[model samples]
Target chain A: MISFQHVTKIYPRNTIAVDDVCFDVEEKEFVSVVGKSGAGKTTLLKLLLAEEKPTQGEIFFQGKSINEIKPGNLPEFRREIGAVFQDYKLLPSKTTHENVAYALEVIGASDQEIARDVPKVLEIVGLTEKANNFPEELSGGEKQRAAIARALIHRPEVILADEPTGNLDPYHSLGIIRLLLKIQEMGTTLILATHNREIINSLGKRVVTLEDGRVIRDERRGRFIL
Target chain B: MFTSLKRVIRSGWQGFFRDGGLSIATVFILLLTITLATSLFLFHGLSHLLISSVEEKADISLYFKEEALENDIFEFREELARISEVKEVKYISQEKALADFTEKHKDNPVLMASLAEVGRNPFLASLNIIASEPGQYQAITDFLETSDFTALIEKVDYYQRRSVIERIFSLTSTINRSFIFLSIILSLVAILVTFNTIRLAIYNSREEIKIQRLVGAGSWFIRGPFLVQGVLAGILAALICLLTFSLIIWSLSPRVETFFTDLDISQFFVTNLWQIILIQFVTGILLGVISSFLATRRYLKI
Candidate 1:
C-alpha cells in the first residue's frame, strides 16, 4: 500500500507542478490517475518513485516514510515498485530477454532464477519468440510488451504505468490495457496515469482526476469525466 | 560479495562488447596516452644516463711542481680522497703522461719529431679530481688551494675549465626542468583528451543508464562495466607501447652507440626489462582507470 500526505512540488521559476494533494491506494487495488497535459500526474508518480522528493510533504510506502529513506537504500525500495513509461525505456543494445533479466539481475538474482523467470515473463507478454531481438528490431507493441515484461519480471508489489500505451496504436493500446487488467487480477497493485479517455471509460476502476496541479475529483468506479 | 563481483564483471564484459566501436575507440585513445607516458618514462631514464655520463667526463686536473716528490703527491692524493666532496682522484705520473703523448703521435712523423724536440718529458705530474656533485667542485678547488702542499702545486686546471663545467651543469639542469614541465603539460592534455573521449562514449549510452536506474540497478552495478572497459584499454595500450619501444630501442641502439661509444641504449632497456614493463603497465592502467572513473561518475548517478 502507498499513501501521499499533502504532497506539494514546486519547480524553479515559481511553477507549481504538484499542489498540496493527498491520496492512497489499497493493496491489490487498480487506481487510475486521469488528467490532460500539465495536470501534475507525472510529478505525482515521480514523487512515489523517489526520483524527486516532494517539496513539502511526506510519501509512505508500506507504513515507512519514503522521504526519510536514505539514498543508499533506494535501489531496494525501487525493486519493490516496477515502473513502465511512455517511451518503453528498454536498453537498445540489449535483447528482449536481457532487458527482462536486467530487473532481476539488479536485485542480485541467481543465474538460474534469471533464466527461468525471464522466459516465463516474456511468455506471459507474448514476446517469447522475440526474446533474442533487440529493442530496435521489435515493433511498437512488442517493445511495450518487452518493457512490461521487464517491469513485471521481479513480481513487484506495485506497478506504475505512466502513459505506457501513449505511443501505441489503438490495437496495441487495447492489448496493453488487457495486460494491465490481467496483471491486476494476479494481485499486483496497479497505478496507471493516463489521459486516454477510451481506456479510462472501459476500465471503470477508481479514478483520481487532476486539474492544474490539484486533484479535482476522486470517485469509485469512476468514468472519464472532466 | 562473490556474487556481486561475478555479476559486475559479467555485465562489464557485455557492456564492453555491446558498445563495440565506441569502446574500441576509447581503448585506442587510452593506448595513445599510455604510449606517450611510457615514452616519457623511458626518456627520463635516458636523460639521467646522459647526465651522469657528461658529469663523468668533466673532471679537474691538478698539475704538480717540477720538483714535487711523487711520494708527497701520492700522500696528497690520499688526503684528497678523504674529502666528502671528492668522488675520485687519479694520479697521472710525468712518465706516464709523456708515454701517452708519444703513443698518440707514433704514426705522425712531424708530430713525433715535435714531441721529441721538446724532450725530457715536459708534461707535469697531475691529479685528476672528480666531485660527487657538480656544485661541490668549488669546494674541492677551495680545499686544494688551502691544502698544506699548496706550495708544491704548479697549477690547478679547474679555473681554466670552470666556465665549461658551469655551462654543462646549467645545461643539464635546464634539460631536466624542461623535460619535467613538458611531461606535465602533455600529461594534462592527454588526460583531458582521454577523459572527453570516454565521456562521449558514455554519453552514447545515457539512455541505457537511465533505463538501468529505472530498473532498480545500484550505482556500482551500472558503473562496473565501464570501469572494466577502461582498465582493459589501459592494459592493451601498455602492451603495445612496450613492444614498440623495445623494437625502436633495439633497432636504434647500434647506430646510437656508434656516436656515443659507451652508451648502449638497447642494452640498458634489456637490462631493466622488468622495471620498464612495470612502469609502462602501471602508467597505462592508472591513466585508463582514473580517466574512465571520472568521466562515468556523473552519468551513473541515478
Candidate 2:
C-alpha cells in the first residue's frame, strides 16, 4: 500500500538524511525501521507525511505521489495516516480526552461519534481514569498511551510511530511495544522506527535496518543486527 | 458547516478561558489600542472646539467717519451681512461705543480720566464683522474695501489688525494640522505594538498549530479558534474601555468646563453614546481579528 522509490533527502551543508532509499509495504503489514541516532528515520516519516519535500525521488501512497498533492489537500491526505512522535506532541492545553478527540474533531466528526469513539479509544489505551488530565500531569507511559489513543482514535489506515518509547522505562517500553502489536493485529499497517535492540529483536517482525543514511538490510522475521 | 463553526467557536472559547496568562496579555494589548483610538477621537473634537473658540475672538471692525450718517452705516451693515463669508455684522452706535468704553475702563483710573477728558463720546460708531473662517476674513475685507460705502466708511480697521488676524489664522490651521499628524503617528504606533504583542502570543502556540495541521485540521479549522479568541478579547477590551472612558469623562467634565465654558465634554459623550460604542467596538474587533489572522498565518503553512 506504500512505496518509497529511491528517495534521497539532503539537508543544508551537504548532510544526507536519507540516501537513495527504496522500500514497499503490503497492506496490513507491520514494518520496523531500525537505525541509530541521526539515521534519517524521522525524516523518512516527515517526507511521507508531506511535512518535508523529499530532496530527490518520490514517495507513493496507494499509487499517488505524496509530493504532488496540493497544499489544500494535505490535511485530508494526512487524516488517512496517524503519527506518534517521541515527544508525544499532544496539545498542551487540551486534556487527555480532548487530545484524543482532536483527531476526530478535525475531520468534522459528529459530536456523538467523538463522544463515543474518544472514550472507547482512551479505554483501549487504558487511560480512561486520566482522561481529564493535561499532558504535563501524565507520566511518561501515560503520555505515550495518550498519544497512541489519539493516533488510533480515527482508525487511520497506517500509523507511523517515531521512537515512541524512547522516553519510557523498560517496563513502559515493553508496554508500548505490546500496544503497537495489538494495533497491528487489528489490521492497521504500522511503521515503527526505533533503535532499542531489545524491542526490535523481541518483535521478530519485518525489519529495515539503517546505518548512517542507507538501509543495509531488509528481512522478514529479522532480528536486531548491528 | 454550522456544526463545524459551532465546534470551532466552542474550542476557541475553551482555549481562551483555559490559557489565562496568554489571553490576559492579548486582551491587555488590545485594550491599549482601543483606548488610544478613543482618546484620539475625543481629542479631535476638543481640539476643534478650542480652535473655533480662539478664532471667534478675531473679527474686523469698520469705524465710521465722524460725519457719517447712521442711516448710511446701517445700510452698509445690511450689505456686509449679505456676503457669505461674513458670519455676523453688528452695528454699534456712537453712544453705545462710548458707554462700552467707559464700562471697560471703570477700574483703570488713567483710562477713565482720559475718557472723561474727551467728554463728548468721542468713540466712533462702527460695524463689527465676524467671518465663518479666519481665511474668509480676507475675502470679506476685499469686499468691504471695494464696496460703494467706502465713501461713507472711514477706515475699516482690518488693515491695522491684519497681522493679528493672520496670526490667529495660521495658529489655528497649524494646531489642526499638527493634531491630525500626531493622531496618525500615534495610531500607527498603537497598531504596530498591538500586532507585535499578538504575534508573540501566537508564536508560543506555533508548535500546537503545527501539531494540529499534522493531525489533519483544515486551515480554517485550526485558525477559527484563534480568530474566535481574538473576537472575545476584542469585545472584552471594548467594554472595559467604554467603562474607563465614561468614568474619566464624568470625573473630568466639571474641571474641563471650568476652562472651556462652552464645551461640556460629558454632554458631548452622552449625545454621542451610540456612536462612541460603535467606534470602540469596531476599533477593538478589527485590531484583534486582523492581528490574530496575520500572526497565525505563518504557522498554518505546515
Question: Which lDDT values do the candidates have, in the order given?
Answer: 0.88, 0.92
Give one digit per residue, the lDDT tens place, for model 2 in A15-126: 9999999999888999999989999889999999999999999999989999899999999999999999999999999999999999998888999999889988999999
What's the C-alpha lDDT at position A50 in model 1? 89
Residue-wise lDDT of candidate 2 within B202-222, one digit each (tens)? 899999999999999999999
Per residue, candidate 1 scores C-alpha lDDT tens digits across B1-302 of 67778877877777778888887887788778877877787788887888889888888899999999999999999999999999999999999998898788789999888877986678999999989887899889888788998999999888998999899999999999999999999989988888889888888887788778767888888888777877777777788888888889989999999988778898789888898788777876777677767776776666
DockQ of each: 0.68, 0.80
Q: Across residues A1-226, which tens digit of lDDT does each residue of candidate 1 receive?
A: 7998999999999999999889999999999999998899999998999888999999999999999988778888999999999999999978889889889888989888997888888889999899999999999999999988888889999999999999999999999999999999999999999999999999989999999999999998988888
Docking class of 2: high
TM-score of 2: 0.93
